[model samples]
Target: MRKTMLPVFTVIFFALGWALFSLSNTTVSQIQPRTLTLATTTSTVDSGLLDRLNPVFEEKFNAQVHMLSLGTGAALRTAENGDADVVLVHARSAEDAFIEAGFGINRRDVMFNDFIVVGPSNDPANIHNLESASEAFTRIAQTQSLFVSRGDQSGTHQKEQVVWATANINPQGNWHLSVGQGMGNTLLQSSELGAYTISDRGTWLALKDRLNLEVLIEGPVKGGDLILLNPYGVIAVNPAHHSDRDYELAMAYIGFLTSIEAQQMIDDFRIDDEPLFFADALNEQPNFEQYVPQSR
Candidate 1:
């Protein structure tokens, strides 16, 4: 009995030491506090853009910019509620409204990738050759082609709203289906259903290899009458909302986003030989510092 008791006691001591070792490691990990939460859209997150960008940004900033990827609506809500330090989203109208509501500041157009209507390879809606996005929607509405909607108040959904408004049509009856999810999931659903759907060019491009759908209509080409121009923007939350948030840090990130290095990164952010986004930080308005710094 004494021998057994002694061996059991020795085992307990070894277990205690191992527990302390793990505890010390966890405590060490918690000491740095090198984390920042970025609320951003699903398209960017789902396409693993953040993963590609994070290493550079984190090494430069000496901190991790962990992302909470959601739809634009959900991300804005997170920013508004002070649940995140910064937000990267694309919906222009909603973003303007958010800033006007005193929830955000420093709106900077980071980059752009337009929305597109995708359908099965067969093109059952007969919208294959339509030059006008609105006309395509009108025809789809008329024919009642199965249309998959993100359904969530996402940037893609907002664009769809505008397109529907332009076509003077309402997505009613059995014609439209709302997936109420992120871009990747919705694309999968659209593929499975072989339906027509509007999606961000970035997400679609990233998932192109995996999906059987093809782009049916391109939104608002340059010099076109289309209203759906999907320009992504980065915004810092109002300091008044969360005094504890590192406002300066958020600003610095915005600065990086608009900087020449980051613009170059954005310009190079491509997949499968198709550029996911066009850096518009300097294209719309010529800022020498944005595209070409004085040092360069």
Candidate 2:
């Protein structure tokens, strides 16, 4: 009986050892890289900034960054729905509204590139060199010169709406073409139609060589107009709202964006010796309360 018991115990020990080894192998094999999802505007993707920036973060952290390039409104909605970990967008009013609704937290200013109006080289609307974007829109409408509108609720579209509102012109007609497209497509369409459209300077600079369109109205950065000042912000989706959201990773991403290294990368990113985005993360201390919506 003792001999039989010894063999049984040996078999049991071997089985347990094999089981533990198998479990260890399974765990090691199943290890996956951390993934962080970011929803941002198309302008960022179009300007190729992410292409230049994302790889550095991924390699340093051993994580993968999945980016969804949508319109600013759509990107915010994506984060609100818990589909994205964070957002990088330019529309301050919308970003404030999102935070006010409790869908986001830890909002930080990232970078900025002003918006510009571009049109045909011939300058049919005679809006070239205009100091006011509103006045430029007014001329386009008055002449009924074809104007391409993004129509989609993008940040660029929101700025366009503001300019139209400031001009006090209810633009509607065959001449006002609302394409409901992304910035790159809108610029292409504007070029195809020889029409006027508003574009972010970064994208305009990146893709200008491909399109027939030329910058006709500069934003404040180039001393064109104050209303065209376009600032961008990065916001992490509130983990309180969505417990599954990778809030820690999102904050890390935001940290990397505002870090000295990333900010310098943004400053150094250029097209044809012209910096597309001005780094404001370190230098600017904007009124935070101004962007945060007050409870009524």
Candidate 3:
């Protein structure tokens, strides 16, 4: 009986050792080099900009960027979850708070486009050449225009909220419809419904051909709410949050995204020969970058 028990114990020990060795081999196989995960806002992806931008980075760096584009809030949540190696987003307040909290490091300002109030050709709100985004909203409110809001808690939506605040309008009643859709779909809905709306200029340009809506009013010209400035930024996700985080790839992507060549691509990318985003990442950015740097 003792010999039989001894043999069974040895067999079990060998099986456990084999299992451990197999797991170790599997772990080694899973290890990857020069790979990154990035969480970003939908605008960067939806406008088909990434489709143009990422290939260059991949070729140059010999790295892979697994990008996840969600709303600003959801993007930030990815960083918080240690699921992303980097982040590219538009919410300055949230990004600042993220860096301050040590969840993000090495932030660099990237490109930008202003928001626009778009509506049907009928000009229901009659908000063309308004000059001030706030004033345009005031006009829209007073005129009771049919406004379709993305209402998806995205960076664009955040800017819209600020514009409404500037307009000193709460925005209640029949003229408003919250679609809670992505940028492209929202544009389609606004076009199909012939409703007025506020949207990022990049998105508008990207989808302008398929949609009937035209620019009703330009939000903020340069920086102020008048410019209704929309900026994109890249930040390294703090590695402390995830031990296996790909900091090397994240840093590479940051360097690539903020590189002069990348900025030039941004400057050069256009729809129908019209510039969509003005690059603001390198030595010379738009005026907004001067005001908001990595520190403040």
Number of the predicted model whose TM-score against the real structure is largest: 2
Best by lDDT: 2
The better-scoring model by lDDT among 1 and 3 is: 1
Per-residue accuracy of model 1 over 13-71 as CA lDDT, tens digit each: 99999999998788447657467789998888876667877767777877778799889
Model 1 TM-score, all chains together: 0.84
lDDT tens digits, residue span 38-131, model 3? 8987888877788899878877776667889898878988888898889998877778778888888878888877888788998866777667
lDDT of model number 2: 0.89
Query: What lDDT is obtained when candidate 3 is compared to the true structure?
Result: 0.80
lDDT of 2 by residue, 203-275 (tens): 8887888999888998988987999989889999999999999899999999999899999999999888998
Q: What clash count goes with each model?
A: 0, 0, 5
Using TM-score as the measure, what is the rank order of every candidate, best first? 2, 1, 3
Better of 1 and 2 by TM-score: 2
Better of 2 and 3 by TM-score: 2
What are the RMSD figures for all models against the true structure? 6.2, 10.1, 8.1
Worst 10 residues of 3 by lDDT: 284-293
Ten contiguous residues minimizing lDDT sum, candidate 2 = 287-296
Q: Predicted candidate 1: what Cα RMSD to the true structure?
A: 6.2
TM-score, each model? Answer: 0.84, 0.86, 0.81
Query: lDDT of all the models against the reference?
Result: 0.82, 0.89, 0.80
